[model samples]
Target: MSVASEILTALRSEEHDPVRLLRSASNLLGDEIAVMSSFGAESALLLAFVAEAAPDMRVLFLETGKHFPETLAYRSELARFLGLTNVQDIKPYLAQVKDRDPTGELWAFDPDACCQLRKVEPLDAATLSFPVLVTGRKRGQASTRAALPVVEEKPDGQVRLNPLASWSADEITDEMKRRGLPPHPLVSKGYPSIGCAPCTRPVGENQDARSGRWAGLSKTECGIHTAS
Candidate 1:
């Protein structure tokens, strides 16, 4: 079957749960797996799961350089705990940043341009070699992603599989606790949703986990999630 046919068929398959679906996809792709991780609040669960299923999977981290220090540190700690060997750090294009905006205040001025520079461009370089990428997105987390499928396609000629698409906040917490996984430092400090330092804020008492990200703004994703 063609790649498109295989993806469509897999999307309709009910035999594969989240875990089994990811494992099957890895096997189908000949073991070239790219696990894009943000090392955020609930990312630990995905890291742990992938560590167990595919320990050597290429864990891609888009190091936007503007990320919180805590996030970077937690990322390292989590990788060590999970025994992940291939943690690839995808960075921005130096020449573009230097030529376009040398002061690096692009994020403060134009967020869209900043995202294109850091998140979009980096992932474009990172996942080019992989046929499939596993994301830790959950449907219940956001309104836009409420209908996310277990498996979907990206416009970049590859598949974007949301293994935990059906998961909820409670489920994620339970799994993390059950596995004895430590939450990110900012997670318990009112910042249920942690992003880059400048943009991220503490969530309100009744706000969702992702409310802290791009707080007070209509933007939900950092362009990386919406990449086609």
Candidate 2:
């Protein structure tokens, strides 16, 4: 079997233990792993795990330059609060942005292409050296993510390690509160799932956590998680 399959099979036994799962991956991958975080509502929980298991593990954040001022500030605050020393901001190439999104109106016309220019390409470059990537995505976040697994290899050969894959929204919130983790300021205003400012909005209490993201559009993911 491949390395990805072996890790998945090994992680199956520790599915319920997020911390241990994180540690196991860290032990196995060592410096070859990094975490991708949006620093959204429930991000603190996963960040806490990173701080515990491997404080120096690189955390990649897509600095799409379209985020709300609050999100940018919260990103810095949360990283400092968690003592995450290596939170790196991945930004798109200026020439690419200028050529593809001159007026920055690509999001209005084609969000998929916009995401590819901004998020996907930058992340692909940022994570090229790392064989494994850790994410905070959970199964309960959205319909598209309902079948998410703790460990899975993407078609691009990147192994995504979702330690919180089985965690529910409530469980995430509860744990964050218990740990006294600071929340993303927008969460209180109903923005449960925060992303780029243009694409994210506030949702109702009954809506799925990710409903606010790319609201009213058929688009669910930003094309980062999907294979290229």
TM-scores of all candidate predictions against the true structure = 0.91, 0.94
Report model 1's TM-score to 2 decimal places: 0.91
Candidate 1, position 146, lDDT: 86
Tens digit of lDDT per residue, candidate 2, span 78-177?
A: 9899899999999999999999999998998899999999999999888888878899998898989889988877776777889999888888889899
True-structure Cα RMSD, model 2:
1.7
lDDT of 1 by residue, 60-112 (tens): 88888888899999999999988988898888989988976699888777777
Q: Residue 146 in model 1: shift from native, Å?
A: 0.9
The list of candidate 1 runs beyond 4 A from truth reads: 1-4, 7-16, 155-157
- On lDDT, the leading prediction is 2
Candidate 1, residue 216: the lDDT equals 75
Score residue 119 of candidate 2 by CA lDDT: 95
Candidate 2 Cα deviation (angstroms), residue 73: 0.8
